[model samples]
Target: MLVRKMDSEVLVLATDNRGKIVELTDLLKPYHLRVLSTKDLLLPDPEETGSTFIANAKIKALTAAQASGIPAMADDSGFSVAALEAAPGIYSARWAGPQKDFNLAMQLVHYKMIISKSDDTQAWFTCALALAWPDGYCESVEGYVYGRVVWPPRGDNGFGYDSMFVPDGKNMETFGECNINRKKLISHRADAFSRLVNRCFKGRNFDGKRLLSFRQK
Candidate 1:
């Protein structure tokens, strides 16, 4: 089937999370697209019923794309510890409970690791990105950044479990401790987003120069 061309430049991001909106908007800065979040449009969030990151991302993307009659993008990401056998792989956010208190969630993770009596600190963050058109056509990709979990959670820069994750090869600085530019350089979201852009936006008539102009505004 022939995929419909994206005639509109506006792309709705299917998420209400402010942190995600900021990260995604920053990532898409180079593209000649106007980004809008579900919160900005006051769109209802679709339930993430999928079993995996890719599936969940597709659900959000398709829902927003169809609802707004425009192309949309969504991201589903999580933190998994090797010792826990990735218990919170998909339920990372749920671990924070209804309050969305990630501090409590981090404490829970540390507690679980202690109860398990496993010394393994090996962990990883996974990100899945999905891009969907109004007609339901979609593309999805996943990326990962392997690292080890730290104790006493350091830094206060990033959201979620960033304070505890120290990506491999970094100078022992947790994501929360690193500046946004440094974190973006090796983040799972950045890896997946790069692939998505290459797959969907490359070779298009997107004006690269507009990125500079948009930033200036």
Candidate 2:
């Protein structure tokens, strides 16, 4: 049964990414913690205008915490394309276009490389998870997974750029080509969430706009 209480030691994850939710579900459950999503509260999502992944994650976390007056969490992450000089970094979502055309985004990347005559298809996935308390305190942890980009696409399992992301040493397929358990083992989001579990604890204090303070105690 869903509990209804303001002071409950709950975590409001500030994201709408279902893939991430699925990836993080198990890691969060062991704490016996109440996990809530923006969808559950019908909350408005904040605009991710931050220039960096950390900045964006923090923005969303604080927004949810402030909006719901509870401890909240968020993650902002994407792929860094080496050929494009790490471009489409913050633009990963937009690259898929306003309609989120994953196919077009994949084609665009391949086309860009094919035209450039550069096979530097090295890329990596990254995610930064931010946690914030009602008092305005916030903390964040990051995750990274190195991988290579594939051109023809691969198996269909994961979503958004996954079909074209092939991890190093395994030339078999893309992230979409791998199963959920396999994906979790080497995914960036998984790494970040793991860090959160290690260093994170309840209760903290707020510093200011530039930053906030969170402690193990």
Q: Write the per-residue lDDT of candidate 1 for residues 55-142, one digit (tens) a residue.
A: 9999999999999888899999999999999968989999999999999999999999999999999999999999998888888889
lDDT of 2 by residue, 112-196 (tens): 8787687788999889999877777777888998888887988778888899898887456688978887878778988898777
Top candidate (lDDT) = 1
Q: Which candidate wins on TM-score? A: 1
Model 2: CA > 4 A from native: 1-8, 201-217
- Please give the lDDT score at residue 207 for candidate 1: 73
- Measured against the true structure, the TM-scores of the candidates, in listed sequence, are 0.92, 0.85
Error of 2 at 46 (Å): 0.9
Residue 97 displacement (Å), model 2: 1.7
**Candidate 2, residue 135: CA error in Å?**
1.4
CA lDDT, every model vs. true structure: 0.87, 0.77
RMSD to truth, every model:
5.1, 7.1
